[model samples]
Target: MEPFMSDLSALSSALAATAAAAAPSLVSVHSHRSRASGFVWKSDLVVTADEALADEGEVIIAFADGTTRPATIAGRDHTTDVALLRFDGRDVSSTPLARDVPPLGSLAIIVAADQGTPVAALAMVSKSAGPWRSLRGGDIDARIELDTGLRRSSEGSLVLDASGRAVGMAVRGPGRTLVIPAATIERVASKLETHGRIARGYLGAGLQPVKLDEGVGAMVMSLDKNGPAAAAGLRQGDVITALNNAPFSSMRGLMRELGPDSVGAVVDVAALRGGEPMRVALTIGERPA
Candidate 1:
């Protein structure tokens, strides 16, 4: 039997209210710079690039009421892939956290679009939620092992959970799609509102995850203009250990500790370069766009 039209309208309104309550409100990010890369969105505290370090900038924010505000660059957290943007002491609405963020291995739905057409995908968490890559735009984020969320024209968009809560944001593309974890929003909300910046240490170098197939160590990837590794005399085939004398287990760990602020601060780097145990000093620099 056909459903009642009034009942359907009521259901839609109820669902919208529930979603409006559950989903974190989004700040539509717009760029005025001609050379700017793409549009960006902010959920008050969280940005689209909280997955992979290296996203930043100033943006104009659009509120639900048609009011607009210019957002200034606070700082970018490469390790956490979170960029902190700020307005003044003025009040602004943000996407509210509904319930708790999902645990790792839970399911989510990513929605994106090109031009104005909307698209979506279903995915499972690769891990409980660590540093994510929000710059890559593609159908699968290899690092996170999700099935959907890459779009050619969906940068600066929101990724919502099934209940209609925003789980992440859209970013750059071509390969593994990038997104921010909802939990990150929890960590940075307060800072975004107050300071408009997040403090992090810097090291000038390029790095990528390495895998040992058998015994011989090799380089998997490199960074732009020689990354922190290059500046620190780090080379390919180097087995990494600690940053700033802190024991690190993975790339994510290294990033988490790199809350760089000073451009010339010396960071302690421990790695097994060329199979020989070694230590080096890395000079951190302000991140580039």
Candidate 2:
């Protein structure tokens, strides 16, 4: 009994220490639409959930010290659900983004602020997997789900690993808690810092992955009326086998090829129509903001 009690005490102390160490970087993000949380990055940048800023009116960054500053949206990417806001607060202590995710069932600490004081929740890394896309089209390097069942206010909370390094940002999900992995955060943040938005190519078609004899390809589930695919004479039920002669395995694979750089570029689409092979040339379009 004594040994178990001692272990529990030590774990509590460690979590408290980690929360304290991460306090300075955690912030409460208040927008016209809702209030959430975020963390300082670099000196002038703050990262938060993009959905928190979707209303996009006046935004305020509130610290545990009771200080507040106005922030301007530097950039936002809906796909990754990350938004970068510019706030040049003096002597800002930023959290370092961890390069790798901890193993599943490891302790994950979620930190936020209450009246300028750090509050935290200890949870396990419930789920972690390799590169995947969100239903909304974010191409994330990994998926991390926490077992905290955190509140909506936990949105944008900084999720830290055992070493107190930030591993992800918490976001509200349907009946669950999700943390956008650190690698995805860093990648999207850098792009947002430079481009103000993620550059995504648009084929203007709804697609699903279909198994093929050689590999996999995206089957056109539907096409936007008069959109790129339609303009290129593509139709519903077309199994697109490849793009630019490269194998297209899934909808995400097709999306990867349709990056912002591919917009306005003409590409060859290899497809199967009525069990017959054919190819079509079409120009990719820029995704509407």
Candidate 3:
């Protein structure tokens, strides 16, 4: 019991130190519709959860020094749940992204100060894997989930490694805490600030993975009404074997091939319809905003 108490005390001190180090970049985001946490991304750009800034109105950013400034939503990506705000105030120090993230099971800290002084919670990297899609179909470059439960108000807090380098941002899931990797945030934020939105190719089809002779391909379970797939004469149960000569290993792979770069471009699609192989020229459509 004494040993456990000592470990807990040491962890508390470590987390406090981390919070202090990251406090300068942390800010409280307040709006009539919502209140959450955010952090400085660049000179005058702040990043936060997209859901927190979904409300249409002005937002206030309060710093640790008690200075509040007005900010406007510069861009938002509902797919990644990331939103960038252009601040109408002085420049601020931005948090540094860790060159190499901590390995799985390494200690991490979540820092946020929605109202006053910054606070932190000790956690561990529970999952770290390859690129995947969010429940909302956001293309995440990496999978990072924390082991600790975070407060809903800490939705956009900066997640840091033990060395105090920024790793990601906290986001509340159905019943878990997910971290949007720093690399993804940096890439998405840069594009959002420049383009106001990320353009993605839309197939307008609901797909699932199906077993092929030796590999996996996407099977169209359903098609969007009057969408690109429908316009291309694709029907339900058609197994898409390849796109542009690249074998479709999974639905994710197919989606990757149909990225923003593919929007509006006509490509050859290989599929199996009713056990017969066929080809179709599909003009990819722009995903709805």
The clash count for each model shown is 25, 1, 0
| 176: Cα error in model 1, Å | 4.1
Candidate 2 lDDT score relative to the true structure: 0.84
Model 1: how far is 245 from its true place, Å?
A: 12
Using all chains and alpha carbons, the TM-scores for the candidates as numbered come to: 0.47, 0.78, 0.75
Q: What would the TM-score be for candidate 2 when compared with the true structure?
A: 0.78
**Candidate 2 residue-pair clash tally:** 1
Please give the lDDT score for candidate 1: 0.49
Clashes of 1: 25
In model 3, where do residues sit more than 4 Å from their true spots? Answer: 1-12, 203-258, 264-279
- Predicted candidate 2 versus true structure: per-residue lDDT over 216-236, tens digit per residue: 878889888867998998889
lDDT for 264 in candidate 1 is: 62
- Candidate 1 C-alpha error for residue 173, in Å: 6.9
Better of 1 and 3 by lDDT: 3
Best model per lDDT: 3
Error of 2 at 281 (Å): 0.6
* lDDT per residue as tens, model 1, 1-289: 3569888787567545543442223444444431111123343343544332224444655544455566665555444444555554235445544434545566665554332233445666544444443322111212333545454334445555556666655454445554544455446544555655554444444455565433322242454455665766776557666666665556655554444334567777777766566888877765553
Q: Sort every candidate by TM-score, greatest first.
A: 2, 3, 1
